[model samples]
Target: MDAPPTEAEVRDRLPAGAAPFAGRRTELAALATAAARTVPGRGRLVVLAGRPGSGRTSLAVQYARSVAADHPDGLLFARMSAPDGSPVPPGRAARRLLEQLDAVPAGLLPADPAAEDPACAALRTALAGRKLLVLLDEVREGAQLLPLLTEEPGCLVLATTAGPLTGIDAIDPVILGGLDQGAAVDLLGELIGGTRISCDPVGAADLAEACTSRPAALRLVAGRLRADARASVTDAAAELAPAVPAAAPQAPKSRGATKPRGRGPAADRRQARELLPAEPVPVADTDPLVAAFGLVYRSLPAPAARMLRMLTLAPTQTADLRTASALVGCPAPEAGTVLEKLAALELLEREPAAADGTERYRVPGRLYPRLVELRSEQDRPAEVELARARLLERLVRLVDSARLLLDRTAGGNPDPLPGPLRLRTPAQAAGWLAEERDQLLDAVRDAIGQGDLDGSAGRLVTALLRALPLTGAAAPADLYQLHELVLRVAERQQAPRRAAAALLNLGDLQAAEGHWPQAEEQYRAALDRARAAGDEPACARALEGTAGCHRALGDPVRAADWYGRALALRQSLGEPRAEARLLVRTAEAHTAQRRFDEAGREYRAAVAVLRRLGEEEAAAALSQALERLRRLVDGEGIVQVSE
Candidate 1:
C-alpha cells in the first residue's frame, strides 16, 4: 500500500488559516509571556484547551503571525490529528515538520520505524540551533507533539484541544472560553457592519447571547446576516433562539482535575459536557467552521464517522448508549466503545451520567449540523432513512411498554414487582417521557415534513399522545402544534378518521386554554370530516367538543343543542358510559339556562345509566345533584342560575 498520507497532505486539506482572528486578547497575552520566557536549548510549549469552534486554531495562527518576525527561521504549522479524528503518528508529524523546515526532502521520510527513527533524530539535530514556531492544531496527546519539539530555546510549540493533554508537562496552558461580550459584539460589527448593530443594539446583544459569544458561531451568524440585506439582527437572533440555551457559566477548573488515562467512557462524556456547552454552532459548506471540522471528520475511521452521522438522529442534544445502539443497530457495549473513541477524537462530548446512571453523550451543537450535512453527502438517502426508521421503531416500543406499565399500575394493580421494565416504574416512565418529550415531538414533525408518516412516524405520534398526559411535559401551544402536524400528515395520507381525530385533539387543547372560538372552529372541521368518514365516535367527540366550547362562551342554548346531538350519537352507538357522561354535561347546560326541570330529568337519566354500569360513586354524586336541583326548582332553596 502507498505510504500513509503525510501530515502536510492533511494540513493542505485544512482552511488556509483562521480568518482575521478577532478576539482572545488574554490568550494572546499568555502566549506572548510564554514566548518571552523561552531560553536557548529549552523551547517552550503552550497548549490551548477549548471546544471546537471556540477559535483555538485561529488564536494559534494569529499568535504565530504576530511573533513570526522574532523567529527568522519561519513558522511551521501541522495538524496533529488525522482527518478521521485519529492521532497522526508522531513520526508522521515529525517528518512533515522536517519537510516544512527544509531539513528533509519530500517523499524521503522512511516508512519503516527503524529508519524513520534515525531520520527524525537527524532532523531534530539539524533544528537544535535554529529558531522556529510550530503550531499543532487538534492535538490529542502530548506525545504526538513531543517528537516534533526542538531543544532550541528560540523554538516555540503551540497546541489546541477540546480538553487538556495529560502526560505532557506543559509550560503554560490557556483555557479559551467564548469571546467576552464586548469582543463578540465587536467581531459581529466587523463582519456585518456597524449600522446593523446601531439599528438594533438590543437585538445585537441578544445575538451575542444566542451565539454564546463563540467566535466561530458569531462569524457564521455575521456571514449569514451580511449576505441577507433584509435580515435584521433580531430576525437572525430569533432564528438561532431555539438552539441557544442560557449559557452555563464555565466552572472554575480544579487544579487536581488533570486528564486521567483510561478513564471510563461515561466519565469522559461527563467531563466533556461540563467543559463545553450544548449551544449549536452553525455550519455551512463554505463556512470556515465547516471546512475546519470537515478536515478532522474526513480523517475519522469509517465506523466512527458513521457513529457521528447516526448521532445526528438524536432526539435531543445528548444521547445514551441505548439510543446510540438503536441508531447504529449495534450492541450497547459496542456502541459505548464507539462513543468513547468519538469522545477521544473530540467529535462527541461525553456528559455525566443521569440520575438513573445512564451515561450520556452529545455532539457539540456547532458540529451537529455539520456532521448532518456530511452524512447527507456521504451516505445514500435510503441508508439515512433506514437508520431513522430503526430509531423510531425503538422509541415506539419503549413508549408503548411504558404506557402499558403506567395503565396497569393505575388500574388498582399492585405495585409492579421489582424487575426490569423498558421503563422501571410508572414514575420513572413519566420522567423519561418528560425528558424525551422534545425529541419525540421533533421526530413526529420531521416525519410528517418528510412524508414518512405512514410508517414509524404514525406510531411515534400515537405513542407520544398516549404518554403526554402521564408526563404533563408539553404546553398547550406545543400540543396544538403537534396535533396540527399530525392533522397535516393525516390529510396527506387521505386518512379521514385520523384527520378527524387530530382536529378533535387540537380542539380539546384549544378549549382547555379557553380559546373558545378557535376550539369551536376546529371542532366543526372535525365534525365535517367525521361525517364524511362515517366515524360516529369521532362525530360524538367533535359534537361534545363544540358543545363544551359553547358552554365556556356562555351560549347555553347552542351548548345544549350540541350536547343533545352528542348524547344522541353516544346512545345510538350503545356507548352507555360515554352517554352517561354526555347526559351530565347536557344537564349542566340546561341548568345554566334556568331550565331546572329539564336539567333534573337529564341528571336522573345519567344516574340511571351510571348505576346500570356499576359506577356507584358517580351515580351517588349525580343523585345528590338531582335532589339539590329539585329543591331549588320547587323554591325550597333559592338558587340563582348564571348563563
Candidate 2:
C-alpha cells in the first residue's frame, strides 16, 4: 500500500522555514519542552487545537523540525483525518505506522478482526524500546491516536486537531489564536519584502488586522501582494476591508434598556482611513474570510467561478476531472482546464497523480466553508438543486453502467445518459467506485436534507446499493445509513414505490448481516407497502426477501411457502430469470426438510427454465443438483414426483 507522508516530507510541505516565524513563539516553546521531556513509562502527548487555517499545522511542523535532533531514532508522520472530513480508521493508521517502522512485512497485515489484535500488539512491542517522534496531524478524535501511541518512554507524540482531545492522560493542550499585531506585520514583511512594508508601515499594520491576523488569511493577502508588486499594501488592505462587517449603531435606550456610548461618525471615518484609506466603509453582513475568498474568486473567469461553486457539492473538497465533469456538466477536458486554472490561482491544490494515473485536486479546507456560503449567496436554491440533481443523475448512471460491465448478473443498466461518459472495464470499475464512494454518500445525504430526491437522488441510492457488493467500498453501516436516508425521502415525497424499494434494500442488507428478525420486519413492511402501491415487482422482491430470512432462521417450511408465492408472481409477470432463481431457493428449502422428491422436481424445472434462458452456468449447477437428488431418492427407495 502507498504510505502517507513521512516526518521529513511533512515538514518540507510546511510554509518555508526561511520565512519569518512571527508569532506563536510561546506555544512553540511549550511544545518543544513537552517533546523534549521523557519518562520511564509514559510518552509525551502535546495537542494543538484551533480553527481551520489557524496555523495549527504550521506551528506543529515548525516545532517538530526545530527539535528533530532530540529524538535520534526516527520521526514518523500520519494524517489521521481524510481530506473529505472523515476520520481515518484506527486499524489503517496502525498498519501504516507499522509499515513505516518496518515492524511488519508489507501486505502481511490481516484484515480479520481475530488476526488484527495480534498484529497491533506485535507492532507496539516493536516500538517498546525505540526513541521516535510520531506526528499525527488533523486528528478529529482521540481514538484515532490510540493505536499510534506507544508506551515507550523515549517516544514523543505531537498531534493537531480542530478541537481538544479530552479524556487523555498527561496531555499538554495549546490553543493557538491569531497572530498579534507586530508578529502579523513581521510575517507580512517576510512574504511581501521589507521594502514594501517600510514604504507603508501603517498600511501594513492595517492589513494584518484587516485579515484578523489569521495566518492563512494573511498568506492569501501576501500572495496577492507578491504577485503584483505594483499593488500597494493599502490596496490589498482595501480589498480585504469589506470582509469586516461594520458595527451597527445601537438603538436608543428605553426605560430599562441600556445603550452604550459609541464613537462619532467623524472619528469612525478617521479610524477607517488609517486602516485602509483607499477603501470605502465596510458593509455589514459579510464574513472577513468570505470576503478574502471573494477577492480571489472574483479574479477568476466566469467558468472558473462556476466550477468553484459546483465543486462545493463535493463533500471532501477534492476531485479529479471525472467527478468535476459530472458536477459541472461539462466534458472532462473542459473540467480539467478549469481545475488547472483554479490551481494556478491557488484556489485548488493539484495533488500528485494517484496510483491509477489520475490527477487529483483539493480545494483548500480553509476555503470550503466560504465556498459554501458563496454558493448559497450567488446561486439560488432552485439552481443549486438543479445542479445537484444533474450531478447525482450523472454519477448514478455512470456507476450503474460500470457495474453492468463488471457484473453481468447485476441486472439492467440505467437509462441512457445525456453527455459522453467514460465506461471503465471490470477491473477499473471497482477502483472508480472506491474513489467516489465518499462523494456519492455525501451527495445522497445532501439531497435528502434538501428534499430534492424525487428525481435522481432515489435512483442514485438504488444504484449505489447495487454497486456496493461488487466494489466492497462501503461498510454495512454506511449502506444502512444510505438506505435510511432513502426511506425518509421516499416517505416525505409520498412515493410508496420508492419507500418499498428502500425497505427491501434495508431488508436485504440486514439479512446479509445475519439479523434475521430485523430483516423479516423490514421485508414485511415492504410487502405491505408494495401491496398498497400495487407494485408487483416490489412485491415479489419483498416476498423473496422474507423467504430468505425465514430460511436463514431455520424455518424452511415458511421459507418454502413464501418462495412458492414469489415464484408464482415472477412466472405470472414473465420474469424467467427471477422465476428460475426462486425455484432453486424453494428447492433448497425442501431439500433441508429431506423431501428429496419435491426438491428434485423443482431442480429439474429450474434447470429447464435456465437452459431455455441461455444461462449456462446456472443451468449446469442445477442439473448437477438434480442428478445428486435423483440418486439419493433411488437409493432410499423414495417415490419420484413428476413436474
Summed backbone clashes in each candidate are 11, 0
Top TM-score model: 2
lDDT of 2 by residue, 133-159 (tens): 777778988777776677787777888
Estimate candidate 1's alpha-carbon lDDT, on a 0 to 1 scale. 0.69
Clashing pairs in 2: none
Off by over 4 Å in 2: 1-46, 57-172, 179-206, 209-212, 234-310, 319-361, 393-432, 458-495, 535-541, 555-643
lDDT of each: 0.69, 0.72
State the weakest 10-residue window (summed lDDT) of model 1.
267-276
Candidate 1 ranges beyond 4 A from true positions: 1-52, 55-291, 404-407, 410-431, 472-479, 576-584, 595-643
